[model samples]
Every structure is written in C-alpha cells, then in structure tokens.
Target: MTRPIQINNHPFRFLLYLEWILLAISVITSVLPHPSPRFASRFPELAILNLTIFGLMGLRLPTSNNLVKIIYTACGISLIFITGLFGGRADRLFPFLYIILVIRSCLIFQLPGRLSVTFVSFTLFLTTLLYRIPRYPLPPQAQEKFRFFTLSLALVFGLSLVFVLILMNTVLSERESREKLAIANEKLRQYALRIENQATLEERNRIAREIHDSLGHSLTALNLQLETALKLYQANPDKAQSFLARAKELGSKALQDVRQSVSTMRSNPLQDKSLAQAIDILAEDFQRSNNILLNRQINLEYSLSTEVNTAIYRIIQESLTNISKHARATEVNLEIIINRGSLYITIQDNGRGFDLEQNTTGFGLQSMRDRALSLGGKFTINSAFGCGCQITVDIPLGRLIS
Candidate 1:
C-alpha cells in the first residue's frame, strides 16, 4: 500500500464513508431469512464477522498515517475474499462485497491502479461462483444458467459504480479550485486598502507643513516689522511710518498666500514651474520683505513627482521660517545639489542658535523632519547656543521621480 487517502470532510467524502456503513447494515439484515431464520438464531457467526469487516473499511480515526491507511486497505480487500469463499451458498448477496472493494480502491488509487483491483475482483467472483455451484444441489442446466446471469449482472454494476466515482472526483476538483480563487482575491483587497491608508497619512503631513511654512513665516516677519515701527514712533517719525506701511503690506500678502494654499493645494508660488525656480522666488521675497541678506545655490534640473516636488518646497519653506522666528542672523546661505539620484539640501546661518537637547519643545523642527521622512528623505540639524545653525536634508529620488 502506498499511503492512506486523506481528504477534507466535504459532503461527497462523507457519503463515501457513510455508504460502507449502510451497506454493512444491509448485508447483516439480509443474512438471516425472516420466515425461517430470525435475527438472533438464524444468522451464522461467520456472516456476522463478514459484516464487521465491511463496516471497518469506513472507520475513521483521529489521525491516519501511512501505516493506518495500509492496514485499512488490506482489511477491505480481505473482506471481499472472505465473503466470496466462506459466506455460504445460501447467502446469495456475496457479490455485493466486490462492489464495496471497487469503490474503496477508486478512492485510494489512480485509474490504472484501480483497474488492477477491478480485474482481481471479477476473477474472484467467478471462481467463487464455480466453487459454490457444486455445493448447491442444482442440475447442470440450472447451474450453467445461474453462472451466466450472475457474471452479467456483476459486470453491469461494476461499470455503473466506476462512472459514479468519476463524476464525484470531477465535482470535488472544481470545488477546490473555486476556494483557492476566493482566498487570493481577499489578499489583493487587503493590500489595496493598506496602500490607500498610507497615501492619506502622507497627504495630511504635506498640508501641515504648507500651513506652517507660508503663513507662519509671514506672520513672524510681520510681527518683527511692527515692533520696529513701535519703538521708532518718537525717535524717528518718518522711518516709523515707512516700517508700519511695509508691515501692513506683508500682512495682506500673508492672507492671500494662506487662501491660495487652501483653495488649490498644488497651487503654490511654484505653480507651473520647477522646484529651483520656486525656491528662488521664495528666497527673493523673504530677503526683500524683511531686509535680510539671503544667498542660495540650487541645482534641481530634473522632473519629479508632484508629492516629492511639493515636499521639497515645503521643507525649504519651513527651514526658512524657523530661521526668521528664532535665528538673529545677518546672513543665511542655502545650497541644494542633486547627485546620483539623490537630492541634498544644506542651509547655514550666522545666528545665535539654541541647545538642541534642552529646547526640544517646538513644532518647527519636528515639522521639517516629518516632511523629509514622508518623501523618503532624511533631515539633520547641526547647531549650538553660541555658534550657528546648519540644517541638511537628504532625499532619495529614484522612486517618486516623474
């Protein structure tokens, strides 16, 4: 025996096992004739043993290994032989044992292998019929006629059982295929949902950076200009008027920029332009409006995804905003270079910086870091309280470049 057949408990498999139990019950019931032989006294012990062996074919254990399957198959084949050889001439239903054997063989073996089992079953039934003919006290004419009818009926039943087994196998194979397809579709749906969630989170971070960069920077600059105007009210009357007028203009521009950021998220001062062009415009405006010295060197000459382009622009904007708010510097230098599919940005300012470890409570540094990370970039700040501040952002450009 190669191995035991193992199958899931589908309706068809249950029927395969259940059929043997029903067949055994049928044979045992018919063993003792009702008129002359009732259930208790008329049924022979040998016939009862035959029914027990047939029912054992359908016995299911908790776990069946190769050894268990081998033993089970041997017992089923043995029952067929025992029934034909010793089931007695009075038990005319011994041919039914061949039907049970053929069905069990179909479940365990392939087509060629099961055909071997079928041939053996036919030979055994014919030999048993010949053996019992002499024992039956029938004359030559009646014995010959009985042998012909028994062989013809067994042949017909065997072919019909083979056809039914083939149909059951086809149905079970189709059911297994449909179940695999359903599992694959569910995995694809879960993967799509995860991608959508990640995109939503990145968009939220982009918007936060935008609001902080444009509006926050403008408000800080406007507040500084107004303070200068207030102190110069009596000492320098004409300069105070000039400073106030510039503060009012900056306030109006800040309001417009905020509206533009909200109305069209993609519509920045950098609309329809390259990232370098956008950053240049931002630097010029900050220098002219605040009367601060700004120097920039940028080399972004390739097309990239909108999200990446937008992320880079906002990172620069947020860095500039933080400098304006906290850094009391005279000159700032911004350098951007793209090399080997990676963009590097470094901003250095000659300002009084704070301790990185102690003053770790603001959202400006955190916002810049978040923007860089969202776009597969890295952000690093190098500074001290007395010395100056240097901010570097490195972003990989291979994945999101357009």
Candidate 2:
C-alpha cells in the first residue's frame, strides 16, 4: 500500500492551504441563485463532488506512480466536463479548478511533464467555455458585450496560468540548488578531517625518529663510556678519569638532544639559522661525537624558504645519525650544490652497508624520503654489503621560490 502524503512536512504547505481556501469559495459560489433553476440546487452537489475528488487526490499526492497521477488528473477533467455540459456553468471562478490542476501537476512532474499538463488544462478550459456558451443564450442586443467579456476572461486566465508555471519552476529550481550545495559542503568537511588525521600521524612518526636518532645514540655511547671507565678504574687511574669525563659529556649531550627535539616539535628544526650554518653545526656535533673523518662541500648561492631549509637540514642530519649508529663507516662525504634551476645534494659513506631492499623500511630512511618528496624532490639510495652507501636528492628551484 502507498504511504499517505504528510502535509505538515511538505515544502508547499502554503500552496495546499491556498488550494483549500479557493475550493471552499468555489463551492459556496456554485450554490447561489442562477437563471437555470433546473440545476441551480444540483450545482452545489457537483461542486461538493469536485472538492471530494481533490481531497482524495491529495491523499495519494507526492507519489512517483505515473498511472496514479494520470488517473487523478483524468477524474478532475471529467468533473470539469460534467459541470460545463450538464450544469451549464462556465463562471469566472470555474477556471480556478483548472489552475488547481496545474498546481498539482507542478508538484508531481518535471519541466516537460508540467508544460504538457498546463497545456491540457488551458485547452480543456477553452472547450468548457465553448460548450457552455450555447446553453446560456445571451439576447442579440447584449451579444457583443457578452462576447467581449468572455474573451477578456479567457485572456486573463491564460496569463494567470503562465505566471503560476514560471513561479513554481523558479521555486523548485532554487530548492534543488540549495540541496546540492549542502551535499558538497558535507563532502568537503569529510575531506578536511581525513587530511588532519594524516598530518597528525606523520608528525607522530617524525617525533619518534627524532627521539631515536638523537637521545638513543647519545645514551648508548654514554653507557659504553661508563663500562670502559669501570674496567680501567683500578688498572689505570688517568685513563679511567678521562673515560669518566667523556661519560659525563655524553650524558650532557643526551640532555641537550632531548631539549632540541622538544624545540623541534614546537618550531622548525633550524630555528633562525641559515641552512649552511645549520649544516655546519650538525657536522661539528657529528665529528665531536664520533671518530669518523667528514668532508663537506656546500654551495648555496640563493636564499631558500624555511620549508626547503628544514627538508635539507633534516635529510643531512638523519643521514649522519644512520651512519654513526649502524654504518660502521670511517669516512663520509657530504655535498650540496645548486645547478641550472635545481638543488642537488649527495651523501656518501665508506661503511659496511646492508642490503638496500632489506633496510628500506627503516624509520630514518623513510623520514628522509618523506622530507625530500614533501619538497617535490627525488631521493635515491644505493648500497651493497661491504660497500659504501650513497644517497642523492635533486629538487627543482623554480616552483619552490614562486
């Protein structure tokens, strides 16, 4: 069974109320005195029948079933024909029934269907006028006046129908546009939420890498120094004291690394330093902490943005940390140069390298790769067992500055 139309929830509740008011007036007008006494009393009953059919059709309203709509419309047309032929009534208010039919058609149909229904209603109205004209015979003296009045009434009704069609179409089109805009806003909200989640995850991973590369390495070296100092305490007093000093230094370095990592979380890694100055500090710290020989050649002629500076600095720092922790390299080469319209960076180490495929998923390597890619650059690492590893990055300069 079809569900009943919920009038309270309808968008056009005002239109429905207007329909009721107009139909009530029409029924009241149909019962008044007329020239033809034969059907004067029955006209009220016919008007009541029309109202009953309208009420019945309203129950089946807001439906998608084409057959149901067509049947209801036919019933309305049939009532119009009966009123004109048998009742001999084509009064001024009668055209309102056809207008009501057009209103209902607007609710049920699209543009093409609406136009078709309006055309049919107008045509039926003309037919009703012609059919009732002969029955209500005007005298020859008033015939011209009656003809002019009839033509004026028809023209007015026609214009009213056109105005209603345009108004209903405009209202429906605006409602549809608002609905589509609401849907688009919801989709954009979901997309922004997803982007926020992804950024949060990446930040957490970066913090993890920073902690591992800085505090982790310093603590490990501190532990080894303490062990060495314990072994030499009794055997050699001077060496034991020196080792103890180095252990204290390592402990201080670990604390400093923690503070730096905290600062990095709150702001950019380089703070206010130039990329060249930041790299120099990183190189000095690495050499002071390890017994590895480092060679550097940096050539940056143009000023770089904070994002580009951070990317370059972090990539170099991560590389140095990885080499100190696992590479077992004695010598490392670092180079940064700008050529044509691109920045190129290369880091090579004479370390006992592991298989590249096996270690590609390491946090340090992934972090460097993410930084390079974020700068719209390419990062490639090549390594083999017992051979040195080389990492090269190339970033375009044109779009970066622009």
Top lDDT prediction, candidate number: 2
* Candidate 1 per-residue C-alpha lDDT over 1-402 given as tens digits, one digit per residue, 9 for 90 to 100: 233344444235765566665566556554645554222323356666766756654544222354554566567667656655655432455556666666666555556646766677777776776665555478889977887887786677567556655764576567668888888888888988888888888777667667777778778879988999999999998998988998998899789987888787634656788887788888987786556798999877777877677777887887777777788887899998888888899999989988989765577888878878877888999899878799999888775579
Cα distance off (Å), candidate 2, residue 9: 3.3
Error of 1 at 383 (Å): 3.0
Clashing pairs in 1: none
For every candidate structure, what is the RMSD over all alpha carbons to the true structure, in angstroms? Answer: 6.4, 3.5
The collision pairs in model 2 are none
Q: What tens digits encode model 2's per-residue C-alpha lDDT throughout 7-98?
A: 75566888888877876676666766778765464555765676667655654465567787777678877775565454423244567877
After superposing candidate 1 on the true structure, give the runs of residues whose Cα lies further than 4 Å from its correct spot.
1-9, 13-168, 219-267, 274-277, 288-291, 299-308, 337-344, 354-381, 393-402
TM-scores of all predicted structures = 0.64, 0.85
